[model samples]
Target: MSYIRGYDPDTLREIVDLRECQERLDEIGPQRSLPALLERVWLLKVLGRLDEALVISEQSVRVARMAGTRKDLLRARILHATVLQARGALPAAMQELTTCAEEAEGAEWSGIAAFALQHRGKVSYDAGDYDEARTDFKRALFLRQDAGAADEQLESTLLAIDAADRRRSRTSVAS
Candidate 1:
C-alpha cells in the first residue's frame, strides 16, 4: 500500500480503496508495515474523521520507529502534524512540524522540509505569531519554488502570507 503525501485525497483513493483500506491494513499487520497504516490514516483524514486519523497516524509513527525507517517516521510525523493543525492544536502541531523540519533538513528532503515549514508557518499565523510565521512562510516559499511545485500552490501560500502581513500591519497601526 502506498501512502499519500501532501493533502491530496483523490489521487490517493486511486491507489487504494478507502472503504477496505482499514481491513487491508489489519491484514498487513502494524508491526511490519507502517506504510499501510499511514495510508489508512490518510484516508480517514480525507474523510474528515480527524480523531481516528490521529490515532492511526500516531500508531504509524510508533511502528515506523520500531521498524527503523526514518523516512516512514518522518512521513507519519508530518501527517500527524497536519491532523493536529486541523484540530486547532496549533502548539502541538507546530512542535511536530518543527521536529519534522529538522529531520528533513538532515535527510536532505527539501520538499518535505518545505511542507513542514509551510504548515508551521500556517499554524503560527493562526496563533498570531506573525514574525515567526513570516520567516517560516518565506523559507517554505523559497524551497517550494526551488523544488518546482505547482505554481498555484505556491501562489496560494504567498497570498496567505501577504494577507497575514497585512493583518499584522493593520493591528500594529490600530495599536
Candidate 2:
C-alpha cells in the first residue's frame, strides 16, 4: 500500500472512526512499507490495542534498520519507544528514547531530538520523577522553539505545567 502522505492523526481522531480506518489499513497491511506500517501502529496504539501496536512498532523498526535512512530509522525507533511507554515498560522505553535522542543529535535532526526529549520527559512524568520530567520538558521546549515547532511548543508547555503540578503535589505529601 502506498503511504498516505500528510494524513494528520489529530484530525483523523476528531473526524473519522479510527477503528474503521484501522480495518481498512489492515486489509492492505501486507503491501505496506515501513512508513505505512508506522502509521498503522500509531492508530492501533490509540485504539488501545497495545499488543498489536507493539508488534507492528517492532517490525517497523526492523524494516527501517534494513533501509538505513537516518530520519526514517529515527521515526520508527521513537514510535517503538512510545509503544513501550504506553505498555508501562518505562525502563525499556527510556533506554530506547535515550539512544534515539543521541542518534538524532548526532544526525543534527532537531525535530526528532526535540520529540525524543519530550517523550523522555513524558516517561519521567509517568514514573513520578517530576523534577527530571520538568528538566527534560524545558529542554524540549527550547528545541521546539528553535525549530519553530509551534505545535510541539504548545505540548511542551502543557506538559511542563503538568510536571510542575505533579512536583508540587509530591512535595506537599512529603511535608
Candidate 3:
C-alpha cells in the first residue's frame, strides 16, 4: 500500500480528511529513500505543508538524479514542478513542466509526457489562461490514450478539458 491513501488516483487531489493525511505522514516518519521521500512530499503538499513538501521534493529530485533512472528523474521533476505550482510559482512550474514534457515526448515516453502536460495544463488554468490549459489538456488526453493510460487517467483529463472549456466560456462572456 502507498504511504497515503484517499486521493484521486489519477489527479492526486485530496478526497479524504486533512487530518488523516497528517496522521499518515506522521506514521510514515522520515526516510531517505527516494520513493519514501516522494510519498512524503505528496502527503505534505496535500496537507498544505508547502514548505516541507518543497524541501522533500527537492531532495527527492536530487536523489532521483543520483540514484534513479531517467524516468524516475522525470517523475521527480514533475512532482517538484507541482510543488512549485502549489507555492504560486507559476512561471517556474510552467518552465519545468514544459521542459519535462518535451523531454518525455522526445524520449517517446508518452505516459510521462502526458503526466507533465496534465500538470502544465493545471498551472495554466491556475493562471487563468484557459485557452492554453485546454490545449495542453487535449494534447495530454491524446497522449494518455496512446499510452494506454488507465480509464481514471483519461477521465481526469476529460474532466479537466471540460473545466477549462467552461472557464474559457465564462471569461469570454464576462469580457
Better of 1 and 3 by lDDT: 3
Which portions of model 2 miss their true places by more than 4 Å?
A: 1-28, 156-163, 166-170
- Tell me the tens digit of each residue's lDDT in model 1 across 130-153: 778878878888888878888755
TM-score of structure candidate 2: 0.79
Best by lDDT: 3
Better of 2 and 3 by TM-score: 3
Residue-wise lDDT of candidate 2 within 37-131, one digit each (tens)? Answer: 88878777777789988999999989998985878898899989989998999999999999998888788777789889888877887787778
How good is model 1 by TM-score?
A: 0.71
User: For candidate 1, what is the lDDT?
Assistant: 0.74
TM-score of 3: 0.91
> For model 3, how does the per-residue alpha-carbon lDDT over 11-69 read when each residue is reduced to its tens digit?
43546577777887887798789888988998888888999999999999999999999
TM-score of each: 0.71, 0.79, 0.91
Candidate 3 stretches greater than 4 Å from native: 1-13
Candidate 1 residues lying further than 4 Å off, grouped into runs, are 1-36
Q: Look at candidate 1 and give me any clashing residue pairs.
A: none
Rank list by TM-score: 3, 2, 1
